[model samples]
Target: MKLTKTLTSLLLAGTMMLPGAAMAETTLNFVSWQVGEKGYGDWWNAVIAEFEATHPDVKIDFTLVPRDGYTDAMITQFAAGAPPDIVHLTSFEYQTFADNGWLEDLGPWIEKSGMDLDGWAGQGACVWKGTTNCIMLLYFGYIMAYNEQLLEEGGVAVPTTWDEYLAAARATTFDRDGDGIKDVYGTGVHLATANSSYTNDVLIYVLSAGGRWTNKDGQVTINTPETIEGINRWRTIVEEELTPMGMVGGDIDQLFMEGKVALRIQGPWINGFVQRAEPGIKEHLKYAASPLQPPLGGSSNVITLASETPQEKKELAWEFIQLATSQKFQELYSELGASPAPRPGAVNEAAFAAVPHMQLLIDATNAASAAGVDRIPTGLEAQNNEFAKVAAEEFQRMLIEKLPTEETAAAIQAEAEMLQ
Candidate 1:
């Protein structure tokens, strides 16, 4: 009787094992640009942990690639018909992917799943032709970090208008050694490439001057009178007013580190680096909102996200993106002083609580978010950058060498047509 009971128990165990074997495992692969940097991969891991905990039947696999080759790598993977289950797409690169029919239509997913994409600042960037191919994960703003002591020494008030900014730039620049040659520059011009890489600041300038890149019909309207004038103004700043820093396309981040430049229009990622590099400069540092046109006619500042992802994974990508761009995550990032939230309400309370001056930035973000629009980052991105480069270089050459404005404007126009 004991032997019979043992055989019956063995048979039951075998039957239970069959069901376990039949259960299928679902694994989702996520690709992002986070290979070399330490602590950068933490967010992805945290999200994965949260996702795995909630969905026990599914698994997540993360693939970190270098930021330099991120877009190319994604393209290669997507072309193989085995793209990742999720991808990080920048606003600037989204256009190329959308143009190629590589992305999935996320409109149905958002409508059916009831995701809260409306509150995010980057929602516009994710939408192409009224369809969302990817969800925005974060918002990064670029501002000029100024040296307070130097400003006071130069008797300059913090600039609010373009005129004030130009004057401040002039006052900030002077030869410290009393030599005929000017040794120090008041403003730094990041005259690298003009593409999406080099145009964020210019975008701020153009928009502040009431320039628009496109009409409601999604046609390229880059050659408008206001745009031409805006480009001319940028050229003037680079050529005649500010000292040229000559930072390469990808080297702007490093240039701001040395603190040699008095005013650097750069991103928030450099905040911690500056504090660590020159602890004494903490009290002396201040951030300025990008300049607005006088008489209150400045358009909102916008950002470009570059990404290449496929359709099937877009739904999951949006969920992951929502998590990354949520108010909770934005505050977490703010606490670390990495970057601020893309949305107006997100991270603002904590940001203002941490630093009073941050209120201005938050206000600006709110205003901009309310007014901003999203456009495709066409393949013309490279052309635009090259055109800006030529114009900037020419403006610099003319200003430093005292060339004519008409000649500079002509060169800028000629180069701009090539971008079309």
Candidate 2:
């Protein structure tokens, strides 16, 4: 009888320890498009490792989806009641997910957690319907990146105004070799169909011309005279062959890095590519504010509202979000040369001290208009995406087929009005 009681007691003790051990460990699923990219991937992995070190029981299961289908993938997963614990949301997708009731309202949590929002540069982009749904990770704005050596060789000064920009383009666009073909181009015009670059590139001109696609009342106003002038300016560039033909945003950046293009409008992230490609090339690369208004671009992180997630997992996921937006990670973001951190003080001063030119790019972030808000009203992601597709198609016709700008603008306005 004594031996039997002892064995039973020992078994019960072991059983009790099992639940305790299970309670100590948690695994969270984090989904983002940055997992495999160069600077972004490195920064994310480093932060994850640090978070795991402090919270020994938590494991982050990172899932990387390509940018092309990231939104659709998350939506599908959420519909099936198996969404990732954390989601990376772009400005265009934020309102759609929030309006669909697929994202957690993080206002109360942020208040409870004491996450400061005042210093973030693009904080306005993450709030919807008076609820804070996401937090800004990085704030990217459009800027002019030029090859200093090319400008110098062509005796062209960096353009400060629209007329100057056009003059510089004409001056620098010439055949370096007498091969009867132009070996270099002055700039690039992104006219690809069904792409955000087309919309953003157009926005730079539209906003610069004091024309906006939509007004404060959420109305579509694409056919205004200012907008017409903007489109005409872009058409002139195409007609004059100042920029390379059949090039998109990516092509512009690549050509700029290869020293084939004299100037291009790109985000701060391009500096990282320039630094990595050829260290000495940094001396030749320079950045300036766009000749007109700068378009805002970047993404935020949010927690998803999917079924079957344990409360502990939710808490752990929230902790990860807090850590990500913390000053330490923000500084890491700057140190890695990803983009300017959303928070004001997070741009690692020491790192920028070494590369002073980056401070100018960071300063340019102040000039950025709110990403989707400046272009369209809140809660119009689906409409905006559709409109972007139609607009890109029409704009391509204008650029490639030599269609009249007025005709193209009217067609674009018709499609946009359908959305309204």
lDDT against the true structure, each candidate: 0.56, 0.72
TM-score for all models, in order of appearance? 0.68, 0.84
**Candidate 1: tens digits of C-alpha lDDT, residues 1-420:** 444637755765576688554334467776666533323355457666776776554577777775555667867877776667665666666555667676767667667867666656656656667767666555544556777776776788888777887787788777677887655555665564433444545555666666655545544555567765665666666766465556652354433444444666555544554555456655677777756531111112222222344433454555665566566765655544445555555565666666454654455444554554322223343343344456556655665787665666566555655566
How far is 322's C-alpha from truth in model 1 (Å)? Answer: 5.2
Highest-TM-score candidate: 2
Model 2: pairs clashing at backbone N, Cα or C within 3 Å = none
Error of 2 at 390 (Å): 1.7
TM-score of 1: 0.68
Candidate 1 residue spans exceeding 4 A from truth: 1-73, 80-84, 139-142, 174-184, 215-225, 267-276, 293-319, 325-327, 333-345, 369-420
RMSD for all candidates, in order, please: 7.6, 5.5
